[model samples]
Target chain A: MSDGAVHCVVVTPEKTELDVRCDSLILPMYDGELGVYPGRAPMVGRLGFGLLKIKSAGKEDVWFVDGGFVQVTREAVQVLTDRVMRRDQIDRTAAEADLQKALEIKPTSPEASALRDRSLAAARAKIRLSSR
Target chain B: MANIRQLDKRRKSVRNIRKITRTMELIATARFKKAMDRAAAATDYTKAITKIVQDLAKSGTDVTHPLLMPHESVKAVDMLVLTANRGLCGGYNGSVVRAALQKRAEIKEQADSGCTSVSGKRGISAFRFANVPVEKTYTEFDDQPSFDAVAKIADELISRYITGRIDRVDVAYTRFVSSSKQIPVVETLLPFSGIEVPQDDSAKGSKIRDDYEFLPSAAGILEEVVPASFRARLFKCFLDAAVSEQIARMVAMKSATENAGDLIKSLSRTFNRARQSKITQEIMEIIGGVEALG
Candidate 1:
């Protein structure tokens, strides 16, 4: 099979996520999952918290990003997220600890509870992505 | 004619003033260099974020974030006005303060015009005037900027936005364009209208087209990303303002130092001439006495 045709850059405050060409891109957005390839129409959408997977050269790269946005055009795809973490960077042990801590917290208000839930979900996502 | 004692006193006072300015110039120079380095270092992060945001904003997403929406109600507005804690740079603080005052007036006018709620009054005004509640004012951050401070400010703004305490948020600061020029700017921080793509002549004729997959949901991701993006952007702005202040101060001090040096040189020359004239007159008087005695 020909080498992966997709090329894109994933950026966050800390560093660049992925700058390599790939066959396909799977991004986590606010609405749902999005798949991208070269020569696609331009679009803008809100991003959500989840794993972004890029497949290229028979290899799959995974990144866990906070909510942001993604823009796709004919030539390149850009993913702008607040936090981008590679699979290796996601410490399963730490994530598990955070998840446990989040569960133990007794929230006093609805907003606090929702925040706790988001924290838990983030930790769970980290653990899940690392394990993969 | 001025007496010797008076001249001596005057000379001493000028000398003291000279010393003070000289010291200030040195301090300003050192601080300026440090600030410039910091400002330069911060650009890396800002540019990176800008590019990413631009790209993401350009991409099509279905989720409509709250920050993106403009609130019609003008019940309250939060203005993040950045000014140098210490004033020496020419128009830096004045320009920023002026902009803030203008904005405050505009808000008040809107309220009076029945464009907004009658009870809608300026809630908080931070900095110089201290008329409004100062959420926070930062002086020196280790000669550069502290990330912790930025994070705290960002958190406050985000919480305020999320809670609807303020209908809108804007940042007024001096955008450091060059050493001699800083433009006071007021930019909207909330409602991620869209990422602003820097103008690049090369990209003028070209277009980007690609398709992507959204994981979980686009709306969910936007909910998280928009706030984070906003916070980062604010932090970057603080860094830029700090750097600009230092640079402006440095240039201003450098010139002051040069001017002071020139004044000192001219004064010294005049003092020497005065001393010489006095000595010559005394010698001539003594010679005249000797001739008259002969």
Candidate 2:
């Protein structure tokens, strides 16, 4: 938290992955990516599968996050997810294989469909992240 | 002389047992510290989720999550008992099983077809011996249970609960308070009443309820956050049970080692007395033989 930075905390059920001050942070919402600056109103939103792009000081960092939640206040953004992986950790080949596996499963119910979609999204996100 | 030899053998055996128990106690102590640290690390996540739930509750909106409301009447319930897979942990498994059995008995009339699901071998065997039918048994959850491992179980329970197949869910496990205290308690997991407002320094009385915005509606957020909170709570329970199990084992082994020490002490005392008596008898026999020779 400085003149033009917002503190960001990425939390998961298993562990807290990151806590950093950033100039700008983009979060993956249920529908699309949402960017936040230093002075944003407090809001809560559901997260989807994608890269969490963070630009701090002069460096850029990207992380792959599965569906979770984000609580963005004016001073801070708290991203809570069940899974978070660094950009370098994403494996493109594995993700492509997982995407194929996800596509093959037939969803029996709405919940199953949702789960399948999440897996599909996650696999795609990992592939996209790894390519970059 | 024979008595001294027998005492010496018993003392040696007791000393060996003491060595074993002392080693177990040291191992348990190390594990307990690690378990305690893991539990502490999880507390942050648990508390954060609890805070969000509390803020939602206080936001003055009509919260309408299925998990928040209790099912009508309760036709049947699922009982989950968590115990240690390995059994050197004194009464840790016993306390959990006893509590679970008592709960099973109390809910017998209410639940028509409830079957116990146990996570440890110790508990499953206890239920099996009692002739109680266990529907599921999971032995993979050891002293160190990963979140994914427990999440699968929680996800299953959540799905079953949401489907209305199971009216309620109860779990019996030992709760770790500190290094010295652990209480065995059976609590409701479904129709979850465990979510409470946190009494912490951060974010309490912030009065941000009026300014807060819930994206895609409050209900949509609840759909994800509620289930996640439930999963986290269940995971926390597993962690507590793990830490408590180590404490129980540590205490049990320490006492066993001390008891062995006491037995060795008494055996050595008896050994000394027997040796002295044998020496005195030999001297007397020599004196008698000399007198006879005279």
Candidate 3:
């Protein structure tokens, strides 16, 4: 799989940061993680808030993505997301603070409560990844 | 012949107006630059979202999002009127407002024509005039956009869509195309079918095909993604309009300043000629009297 390189591009609202040929790619989807290679079958998946890892040449790169979508065609791969953060860019202290706030937010009403849990989960993920 | 006193007064008046327009032109230029920077930054965001949306459509998902669902009932429509809080740019506000009014009238006419109803009922009278119930108009901001403002507007639109209060949501704005041309465009905000992705071969070449693993589920992520995308897009639109307005104002002022200069120059020349002629006439009369007395 490493020999058959796959071309991919990752785009955020600010810029098209990565456009390179890669050996393989892994994305965190709503259900689970998915892997793609060159000549892969066409499929689309809902991305979740997690690490998006792409391996190209002999180096691996990781990006913390805030929910977007991924499209795979026969020859190219595209990742479009609102926000993408590199590991170096992620401030551990800020992530921790956000995580703490998310955890402390207790919605008294059922209607407003759903997003709190989601935010908490995201905070935890950020912390866990930052520590690594 | 005009009096010297009157000429002096006219020059002073023109000088004051020149000062005002010159100041305005400078301010408008500065604001226009900032707006352009912001507008450019937002493009990346819009492109990223558009790509995601296209990918979702490509992916065969049973997940039905409310934003995606077309409202079959077309009894009434909601228009979001986005206008500058203050008027200075030539037609920036007026053009957008006019486009909105025209659209409203057209929608009313369609409703009146008695088109076939999707729900098998006389679709509510051809046009129900509903003033854009929600408006987000602002005059000033710090450096960047106020996310809170965008969120407030988004919340209102989302609730309206969810409760079936408005069947469709449309936004009317003046899109900044260039310094000389600001086009008034009306785009659908809700029931998101009008969102377009770049179809050029260059865009196609950039398309990414890969499988993704969702943490919770696709449906859950979409509920958040769609709304966030909408809010981001609206913010971008505001930025675009702001930049366009400032540029328009700057250009308008620059031309006005030039016109003022021309007027002052012409007036001064005329005033000087008239004064000279009056003095010459008095001198000739004095000479004639002296010659007659001699």
Candidate 4:
């Protein structure tokens, strides 16, 4: 880590996508967005499907992450997710189509409703992030 | 002579086979490199998840989940045998099937009812030949297995274990130790008790517990982390099987190509010697005819 930067790493099942020293990190938690800086308390948080913004040296890098988990230690912030992609990688038309499909899913049972809600949230998050 | 002609034919065929085996060896080499890279990349996730699980276990919270608890008694056993879809990889598939069969026999002796699930056509056919009924057969996976595909199977296994449909889940596969060494073994994946927390040397001298703040709660996070760790373990098995398959193929093809080369060399040598002796005989006959005419 530099003077006030924290080491950040994002790992997917297939590979580690990013490893860098960043000034700050804004991650989407299961409940809301949480920002992290150097010397933050060690914590483990469940991630939601949304944007992950890493700011360093007056520049910002953003990525769209599928639901996973994050661990913040004294030295580094680790993000373990299933899928991570750049905002431009999200096809707006496809995301809109997914949202429509998720809406059409009938919540027949508890499991089915849970699935519907998860997909609905994921599609909405994609659409919201890609449009920015 | 006729013998020379036969030798030439055999040499030509051997040469052609050598070409094919050489090509296969090269392909296996390339594929092995790619598979090894993917396996290495997965190590990070596996290490991270294992650390998290260890921490959760040590966080002073009573960790209890369906996966962490053993069944009342051994009843139904699910043995998942991983093999290759295609054969000709020497004893790669054979050893795996053999190991799996031995495990099944042992499990059957203890469990009341059990079923064997096989991945790869080789294992499926072997089980059929052995008159053992297979509960499930997966032939879609090749050298490259996607995480999503493995996760689907893991999800089914997890649900079965949770609902008490099966008492235990075991996987038999070739563990890739390195490029030169692979061992076929059976491992239990469920019950989630295989993870042994490493003893911290620094904390051994004094009682120091790193204070970790949980987002929701330690138990809640453990609930998610445990299943994720299970999925990761299953995926690692798939990856190891894939990489070992390629390495086995590479070595098998290399030896096959070498054998073909040796066969071709000996055949050509015999062909040359036979042709020379035939020429000498014809010359002698011609010289004798000349002597009689004179």
TM-score of chain A of 2: 0.83
Order the candidate numbers by DockQ, best to worst: 2, 4, 3, 1
| Candidate 1 deviant stretches above 4 angstroms | A1-116, A119-132, B1-59, B111-135, B140-143, B197-210
The better candidate by TM-score, 1 or 4, is 4
Candidate 3 residue B252 C-alpha distance from true site, Å: 1.4
Model 3 over residues B1-294: C-alpha lDDT tens digits? 337778878988998999899999999888778777767766765765665555554444343567768778866566665565455567666676667667777877754311111100111111122333323333343234454455556656665565566677777767877767788888877776535533433455644545544434555545666776777777766666667668768878888899889989988997888888888999999999999999
Q: Which candidate has the top score in lDDT?
A: 4
In model 2, how large is the Cα lDDT of residue B163? 61
Q: Write model 4 residue lDDT over A1-132, tens digit each, in one string.
A: 335888999987778999999889899887899999888888887888988999989899999888778888766899988778988998789789978987986776554565577668988988888888
Q: Give the better candidate number (1 or 3) by lDDT.
A: 3
Question: If the candidates were sorted by their lDDT against the true structure, best first, what order would they fall in?
Answer: 4, 2, 3, 1
- lDDT of each residue in B106-138, candidate 2, tens digit only: 898777756579998988899899999999999
**Model 4, clash count?**
0
For candidate 3, the C-alpha RMSD (Å) to the true structure equals: 8.8
lDDT of 4 at B13: 90
Worst ten in a row by lDDT for model 2 chain B: B201-210
The candidate scoring highest on TM-score is 2
- Write one digit per residue (lDDT tens) for candidate 1, span B101-182: 6776786666421111100011122232445445445544434665446655675665555555677777777787777677
- In order, the B-chain TM-scores come to 0.76, 0.93, 0.80, 0.95
Better of 2 and 4 by TM-score: 2
True contacts kept of each: 0.22, 0.49, 0.32, 0.48
**Candidate 2: pairs in clash:** none
